[model samples]
Target: MASSRRRPPVEAPIAALRDALARIDANGPVLVAFSGGLDSTVLLHAAADVLGAGEAGSEVESRRSLLAIHVDHGLQAPSADWARHCVGQSDTLGVDCRVVRLEGAPQRGESVESWAREARYAAFAGIAEEVGAAALLTAHHADDQIETFLLRLVRGAGLDGLVSIEPDTMRGGLRVLRPFLGLPRSALERWARSRGLAWIEDPSNRDERLLRNAVRRQLVPVLDRVLPALRQRLPQTLAALREERDRLRELDRRRLETVTEPSRSAPGRAAALSLCAWRRLPAASRAGVLRQWLALHGARMPSRARLAEMLRQLDAPAADGLEIRHDGFVLRRYRGQAMLLPAAERSCEGAASGFCLPLRWVGERRVEVPELAGVLTIERIGQVERVEPVGPVKPVGSPGRPGLAERWLQAPDLELRARSGGERLRMHPGGPHRSLKKLYQERGVPSWARRALPVLWAHGRPVWAAGIGCDADCIVSKGVRYALDWQPLRRSRPASAPERSQH
Candidate 1:
């Protein structure tokens, strides 16, 4: 009778909005890719509200500064009408509106949906660049994340893919933030409806033919009928799964640090990972480790078949130049090392190990290209043709680039030579196989050099790898684009004529 109890404070969408604003670690003049869809329109409204609350300015000025962009995908039947509706809405809301038209022939053999989504993001990225925005925020609600995670699980993806979407990521050096990952789609609908906000309905969304729509309309409702509490439990279940994924990611991180190279050659990138270390781990651990390694270097994780092949390669001794390919790339090993250079770095030198050629434009001084070391030109060549070397060709064992012989070959064959004793072979298998390039150097070869000189036929095509330990036989032309030629510089030495040099 004497005690009075206080009621709990009410939770609101405004509170949710404020929390999202607070989580943004950096201050922003952020540019939202506002599509005027329910999610984006809500986000635009929320952002404007937050900006005005924080900054010292009039409401009109603050709201006017909020960038509301509407994209006309030109796919749906009434897209222009929808664009006009969005413009009118933005005007009513006192936000600046801009319409962007995305034009491209929908790629054949791909879903228009997929193409459209990619186009939308590309357009957003372009605008973000123009506006100099640090981050682009999207309203990918909890339901979207759940659907994505379920899709990945059904697709038999590893945890990296199963992790679905994250709260944030740095994309193309631009930050992309998804704040509503914890809020349900129903919550967004309810919030909008409460404010008398109407959303444009895309007819494609209702198409039962789409897998996601079938999942939403049939599979999910059936599941909900069977277990009414499934929706409530999903968020927690996702959290638990993510926690498990985090632990796995940490384990993968440790393995990557131990096995991956700090610096690697085009070939060494693959070989840097030790087969012994790979085999020692459990199967699950192997997959986890490989996933982490691929992600680190901006490569997509290999599929189960490809991962199995890599394991097979690990089982094979380092000596065999094993190759495993997936996702349009060929991963090959040489001299107990693996290289991922595109199939084009393979090419013969312009001349022999120590050929002397005069740069005609620069006058009579001879430009010396070392036989085994990298290209060393005392005089520059301005008029030589360009050969974009592909495949396993690399400037191995140089001071700046060890175990990375085939990395970013700059100024290719511009009066190159087999310069003596100063070279090193950034060998495959082993990170830096010692002195392979140095051997050519010690022998007093030319100004620039390669560790192993392949069999270059009369036409100057490299028909073989270095023939010492590795071969350029596997490194050849590409399938899609035109194969690159060995850039300019005429060979002065005969095919079999060996320059007098001894290591």
Candidate 2:
């Protein structure tokens, strides 16, 4: 008979950690997602041992390098106190602790549970990325796993929903780690009690009004009477389903690499791929591939049903062309070609045909494809995009030039505006990657003229001159029946301290 495989040791916090570290292709500097709770307190303590105090501790002391992030979900009455408690714990632990505050009421009618958790997690993620840490450690233990599985079932979630909260997941390059995933909350609580540790007790936890609370206090125990091993079985069940899902997704990806072809040279090739190539996949894979394709280009993913229904229309006729749009996936068939557009570019549509979005916020907009500039409106013959690059900018300011047009353009849309500090560009011909100030001297564009000229950033680099000149190389001739054109503008910058860099 085959021998049974053993579960992970699941104890000794660093033991789980070392194995996780080995699995990654690169060794990530680890950071603990420390909350002042019992679970995370122990997690932080465990992590302190893995990385040395001086080398990994994120403190003002000589023992520095480790980072701890605590998010203040301002939902409870003692939210501030909770944050202070977290900070105090970090100081005691000899790690750098930063408390992030999230404002606004929780999603109404949802008991503030969903919103608070979402906000806290977001703030935690931000701090993790801010530090040079590549991995984030959380203290989600066995009880939480059972709760999660139950919650998913209660909410009518699919098989994927019952899966264990991912112990290691990559979020914007930061891999999330949960050392306590395999351990029970009771174990950690007992350990902390033995160590004589004190923890914050939010009163809401005991209130049975919340479903999670009710589950914690009632349902689980009641079920324990009938099914003793149900809790143990849930996590394993979730793991199996998750493994199956992962394999299927990989198979779909591999199948696509063989069947798909890129034809950028053909007119409307992108559109052609959307209409025909997207339909060739197996019904199960078609929707997934279409969603994947759009997401690759910065578009959002659509619902499975929405994508399937869209392809279902394909049997109608070649002339019937299909346009399916949902969840930011824009599907349009033109000249027997289908195209997917990024939802972030809705404003560009007005410019593409000549229209303007009523401003919700005051800022310049640049369209990189067919190069467009501020208040982009359709123009006769060709569009006009502006470019204005400033000199010496702050990190968050204009990057020395206007936020140029987006980089993913198909031969059009270009514009620029002024921003502050450390802006670098090869503004003048034959110039090294020099500052914008140097470009003005070589071109004699004049100091006063520099602030007035808007920058034309194209493909993350400036490649156009607004008003007086255009990038001599990028212009498409008007003679072509269908040609991409750029209209650029140059303008001065406003003042503001960049509080936080874009995440």
Kindly give the number of clashing pairs for every candidate: 61, 47
User: Root-mean-square deviation of each candidate, in angstroms?
Assistant: 14.0, 14.2
Model 1: per-residue Cα lDDT over 309-427, one tens digit each: 77677667654445555433446554333444332222223334354332232232332233322222222222213224433344423222211012112213322223233333433
lDDT by residue (tens digit), candidate 2, 373-454: 3323222232224422332211112122222222312223333444233445543334355555654455433332234334
lDDT of each: 0.52, 0.52
lDDT at 482, model 1:
13
Task: Evaluate model 2: give its lDDT.
Answer: 0.52
Off by over 4 Å in 2: 1-14, 17-28, 54-64, 103-118, 258-273, 294-338, 351-503
